[model samples]
Target: MHKNFTHILTSLVVVIAITSCDIGDNKDVNPASSFLKIYDSHQFDHAIGPVDVVQTDTEGYLLLGNYRRDDTNFLGTYIASVDSRGEFIRNTYVQGSNVHPVGKFLLLGGQRYFVSMDAVGLQGYLNQVDDSARVVSTIALGVTYPMYAENDGTDQFILLSYNSVDATTVLSLVSADGSIANQSAFGIGAGQSVEEPIIDHFTRTGRELPFFAGRASSGLYYLNGFYNYTLSLLFSDLSDNNPTGVVQGQQDEGGVSGLLSLDGGQFAVSRFNFGDSYTNALATLNASGTTSSNDIQSNPMLEWEVDAKVKMISLTLDGVGYVVIGTTTKNQQIVLHFYDQTTGNYVAVDYLGFSSPYQLGAIEVTADNGLAILGSIQVAGKFQRLCLFKVSEGELLDLVQ
Candidate 1:
């Protein structure tokens, strides 16, 4: 026991020495390969207009966003590629009325693709791109107004769209050729309407509609959106045109804020109501879908008010799994809470960009096992630009589990 204690103390000293010697330029608790970069054109009135970012197959980074102009005057599509060191490599801006980038890139059959809503047809389109950030081909989806696109846990895409005619959420299983294999319209009621959020996104009104959809491990498809005159998580069989189960919530004041799939048929979910943030660190899914009686969050990890956005992501570090809840709080900063996968207990909280305002876009795991967060920043205290915060793999492992 004496020898083991001495060896452990020596290892701790070594870790402290390395961290103190080599940290990010920010002077925060950084580790090797850690970086914080604000990526954009760097020209006046120029923004990268990032929506989502992904680590490319070449071990670099690719960001998908709007071409130019702000939310109101979108010119076309924008693709910015950065090297592994977070340095700018190339920027591709394609201005066209027929292309408007949506959803993050999905890796299908070893190829990366993303969905877009064409400005002309106003219909969802699947665009395949090469490694050089060039669009190889663009195909149109049968569904109109594709709000969110996700992989179906198989080889196809599960498009969560909206029908402008009836203001209902449309679920579709689409092929690579933009073919709809199976589709069903849901969440229709006498007074429920999704027309407001749909128009808000296209018009860049700045209003938000937190929508999420994907296939769970139980082979049931789940969608969190407005359904049955209230915000709910609608579960379906998809074989038939009816809902198999529905986890209902308050009409508009409360609902599922965010959801992320986990191993063993579990999910890490976040909830909010009247600006109060809550989270269920882990929940199981079944045929009827998961639900709660009193509060969706049994033990809240996020103490701040989540007024803007809530996102959850899971990562396995050194053979241990963890769930991280990220929020755009009312404090005008990005807050991330990491939790243990086995115990579902709160681990640590990281408050990013307290000096400047930051908004959450998407959270992803880097190729190096680090944490890559993509968001927008106010550059020079004025211009809205894309920013990335990469927490080194060592720093993250030191925090959770």
Candidate 2:
């Protein structure tokens, strides 16, 4: 089913009263120049949670999310396209046998596609759609759950799946037409691991590589890079591989949540620690995989004793720093933290949302250097609805009132 979703009327008024307060170096930044514009806030009849948002080739926006018709059953996946002004263009529900959509949107061969697993997670598929929101084709992928698809610069893509039955990691190189060109698997033995791989694209050298960062059974964080299409382990922390410095926390209770590429063959990673208290940390690594710097923060308001979670994170296009978004349990507000890479300073900390029960989905940088935060908001003490808004960097710095 499909419908023209509209922004919540009460949210428009709530946003105007919610302003960002500056807490860092703000001499040159203008808080007044910062503005929060609501492109659109949509409330779907069914419960929907956004996963990712990407700018279309035609300068529009496409939002991919999971939807549920009932509390117990998975309705399928939700796809929505909006214009530059956040006006609703069209939306459709791609029914699946699985409980959720576990994939990302890919733009390949000058076409748009939403690739994901079915409800049962045993099979994956790609929905090829036109600009007018019409599905032209649906390509099936014979894979299991915990799989992800990433573009390889060319029209082809790389699919990575973890086989729990055999304790193996499978890599498949898929062509643009949904055919698997090559497939391979690597065994990691019997261990509990968190697998979140990221594809890094370097603009200067036009090079791309995929790296998987997670916590192995050895109780240490490991980052492994793969050879293009071959699924060969280029480098890892294993005994045979040229292992770099292993990331060890006070307790082996945290795992990598996000990864960002930095200048000069360096990268930054975020980890969430759930020990006696909740903590979110950032670390930097050199090209050789050596940890250069590690900064950990636990519960910003220590006295309040509130729990804070790092829900999502993304680096700025210029690689200046990162924007960390999460929720504070006591205050029930979405917190934004701006980290300055060079100085190793948290330049700013701001808050959004007015009440508790606000869930954060994802964060993406806009074309004009602004930020688009995707999540859901509970209205009138009822159900949760999808909420999206853009905030300028200046606004985050408290330069604009």
Candidate 3:
């Protein structure tokens, strides 16, 4: 599919109200932006939405997530549907087996789909869910131990997995019917060391290690993950699933924390080493056959710094271009800084989650040209629950100006 840089962004979504949460011991409400309300999830002990959310044809939403039953390592799959106002309607859960779920929901042929592991056999599961928050069918995948997934904006999805026994990283192109179109593997030098972290991805700061796979605007298939013992952005040849060039990194500098491939082959790249993380809003991708972490760090276009997760996305709004950067700060806040897409000049900034702590997860440009943000809120300053915030077009324009 041709990359639509002008289209709307959507994903796993839940919005908040100005009400106190029933699950927490402390009732802290974020009144920072009247338009920014954190949704309450009272049923689940813990709910995290690193998954995908899509707006239904009705202008409502279908959100997918991972929920822990009782603070265990295992996380069950949870699904919910909400109205256009971000009000909740219905939801369901698929109990966990071993590891946390990965990947966003894929919208294929007007149907909603997602790929993860089946709890019982621990096999890959291609699930088809209805807009009404129902899992209609699930096809078991031959590709096991799945890690991350992303749609090529066309028909197929980029699936990232691991071969624990072989100590290799697996990459596959999966069709809508749950069939593998093309697959490849590369050795992970220290196999057990890499595999152990993936198993613990859900429980810990899953943010430390980021997995990205997508088709860039330059018509290149690229994946940023473990390859040959290191985390590198491996750009592939057009025909085969093989790296033509690589933008490699060291384990010491924390590898690529967030990557958003922009037009003209450039990208909004962010990296984290230990506690500090920073982003280069306007950076190119032609890594010299062997680029390293030092090369990315030498970039002078530093946009912002944070001690937590940093994410970015590019969008063209009403004739103007923007590279929006969202950062989770060490100070218990989520800050959004917008920059001029063409010049990389700073435009505006907004803050969320004042009283209670928040960690940024996902962001989207809603169908109405508004903004949809996904974040995990510490309810009562302790219980972690998923929350979504939508900024109206009027509010967005005010910030842009």
Candidate 4:
């Protein structure tokens, strides 16, 4: 989950089409568009990309990402606040290592905290910048292995870390005061890189039926490993480590492409299949841990072949979820997949085909309903154009739907 800086304001125009495929008849009549641009930091020598964005309790936006200089390995992780209009108000770069932040920002109490996956491992920090970007309190908990963290709102936070000794992965719940409330380990085989662990509170509270949602692994590296089918979900009390039970099992050896949890039983999960050379299904799960009535979203096929090596797939959310598919196609084109969860089939929605030679640098969603897509498009003879887009509902849909 990377966050992109740099904001652009572009007016949106609406239009309608007369297609015979009233097929679903579930789609909204009118769709809107918003264009956004990626944060350009080369001017300052530090390339800044949007990692992840979360809406703060203060009605402001928190943008989390890292900045690095091409001349040095100086990676800087930061958290900044912006208004609803996407105006930068304050910026805070985390203290210590110059590493990148790899995950989403979790809302803890009146404050917000997120996990910073750096050159070393994963470290936890806050976004409240006093003077500069400093951690109010930081901790290096869990195995040095890849880990995931989430906020539960009940004073207890949750984490999933891969354990080498046990040849298994453990899920733990930490209290608000920072204590290991509970923990449990599950064996997903070994030698697998389990990066994204999604946690949801979806069972007990009726409102909390499907609690945890994320990707796991069976350690099938190479083509199979990149399949993006190793997805799972825990639908129990997030305050507890084991969370009572899991609502779903590891389906495809697929990766947990993207995750989004909404109120009620509304949540979205994206699954990608690189081995097959295309972005597959985007499923919507209900509060009951079951796929929603319109569970599967299968639309807009994204199959691009660049320099020959197919680009990996990544997921993000602004006000909505976006599925970005990158490819080694000759032009280095990165395909953008957008879906309108309100009335989508849970598959790939609309797609925008942007061609560049810089290779997709960073892809993230903004809290202000914008998309921060960073990469270089060949310009003149050099790939120097930092692309940005403020993506909105029905906009991306218009392209492929």
Supply the global lDDT for candidate 2.
0.49
Every model: Cα RMSD to truth = 10.3, 9.5, 8.8, 12.0
C-alpha lDDT values of all predictions:
0.70, 0.49, 0.66, 0.40
Q: Candidate 2 — which residues are off by over 4 angstroms?
A: 1-45, 69-75, 96-99, 131-134, 171-173, 180-253, 275-282, 285-330, 393-401
Q: Write the per-residue lDDT of candidate 3 for residues 1-401, one digit (tens) a residue.
A: 21221111111113224243322222342222224445445353455554556667786667767766563545677777777766778777665453355666787777888776755556778888898888888887777667778887568888887666777667788888888888777666674666566556645545436776777788777777777777777777545545777777675245677778777888877776554565677777674376765467423323334435566767667789998888676676778988888877778888767677787777766677766677777755555666666666556677788
Better of 2 and 4 by TM-score: 2
What residue runs in model 4 are displaced by over 4 Å at the alpha carbon?
A: 1-38, 42-49, 56-60, 67-76, 80-84, 87-95, 98-100, 117-135, 140-143, 188-253, 259-268, 277-300, 304-388, 391-401
Model 1 C-alpha lDDT per residue in residues 329-356, reported as the tens digit of each score = 6666777888888878788888776455
In candidate 2, what are the lDDT values of residues 86-115, reduced to their tens digit? 556877666435334444556788887766
Question: Which portions of model 3 show Cα errors greater than 4 Å?
Answer: 1-34, 42-44, 47-50, 70-72, 96-99, 202-208, 238-242, 297-307
Which candidate order results from sorting by lDDT in descending order? 1, 3, 2, 4
TM-score of 1: 0.85
Error of 1 at 154 (Å): 5.6
lDDT (10s digit) by residue, model 4, range 139-171: 555443334565555465666554546655466
- Please give the range of 10 consecutive residues that has the lowest summed lDDT in model 2: 199-208
Q: Which pairs clash inside model 3?
A: 11-53, 12-52, 12-53, 16-37, 16-38, 16-39
Q: What is the TM-score of each candidate against the true structure?
A: 0.85, 0.65, 0.84, 0.53
Best by TM-score: 1
